[model samples]
Target: MVIVGSTNPAKLEPVRRVFAEVFGGLEVRGVEVPSGVRVQPIGYEETFTGAHNRAKGALRTPGASWGLGLEAGVEFNDLGAWLFNVAVVLREDGRTGVARGGSVLLPPAVGERVRAGEELGPVMDELVGQKDTKKGPGAVGILTLARVERVEFWRHTLELALPPFLRPELYPLE
Candidate 1:
């Protein structure tokens, strides 16, 4: 069985899809778990740590052989503050895999608010005048005009992370 770290449907759907496609017939379940990071992780380190922590925490679930975690955050670079997500997979045997999803440049105003201590979900909700856009099309979908839904964005990252698990010989369980 696979235990997902978040009960959010947005996150759970992707894990269900990806695991079904790859592992087949495995039961996928989402349970609420602490991310061990700020609600809005502002940097790569914190975002990655959140993902790892979630996966690790989910593995504690009974009868779970796999744990999945997906975390979204914003980071500023030379270009601008970009929103992205990181996915982490942890197995009962302690093997791990990680992959990062695509990023989108946030509007200056949005970045300002995020930097000033606001969560991206609420910021995006206000920008598009909607409620909980993060759990739906998300900022990427809103900015891209539905060209990329949040589920697909996260699925791509989860797919990438599976390579290590798929080919254990290629990725030694250091």
Candidate 2:
């Protein structure tokens, strides 16, 4: 069984698809667990920490074979603030795999809002005049105009994270 940290369908569906593809017939569940970080993690350290914490928290649940955590946040580089996604998976034996998805520069307006303490989901929802877009296409889909959906972003991250889990000999459980 796999336990995902967030109950948000956006975070859960991709994992379900990826888990089924790699580990057939496994049961997957999304549990609303705390990330133990800011509601809007601003940079890589906090975002990655949130993902790691969620994975550890999910592992606490009885019968959980694996814990999955997904986090999206923005990092400011010389050019601008770019949004990125991170996926972390933790197995029962304490093995972990992590991967990052593609990142897109947030428009100046959106970055300003995010820097000023607005959550990306609400910011995107307001800009696009849509309700709960985060649960659907999300900021990546909206920013990319559906070229890539949020689930797709997670899908790519999952694909990157799965290799180590799939090839335990190569990864060596270190």
TM-score of each: 0.97, 0.97
The alpha-carbon deviation from the true structure for residue 146 of candidate 1, after best TM-score superposition, in angstroms, is 0.8
Error of 2 at 1 (Å): 0.8
Candidate 2 Cα RMSD (Å): 0.9
The predictions' CA RMSDs to the true structure, in order, are 0.9, 0.9
lDDT of 1 by residue, 45-128 (tens): 899999999998899999999988899989998877899999999999989999988899999999989999999999999998
Cα lDDT computed for each candidate against the true fold = 0.92, 0.89
Q: List candidate 2 stretches off by more than 4 Å.
A: none
**TM-score of candidate 2 versus the correct structure, residues matched by position:** 0.97
Q: Which stretches of candidate 1 lie over 4 Å from their true place?
A: none
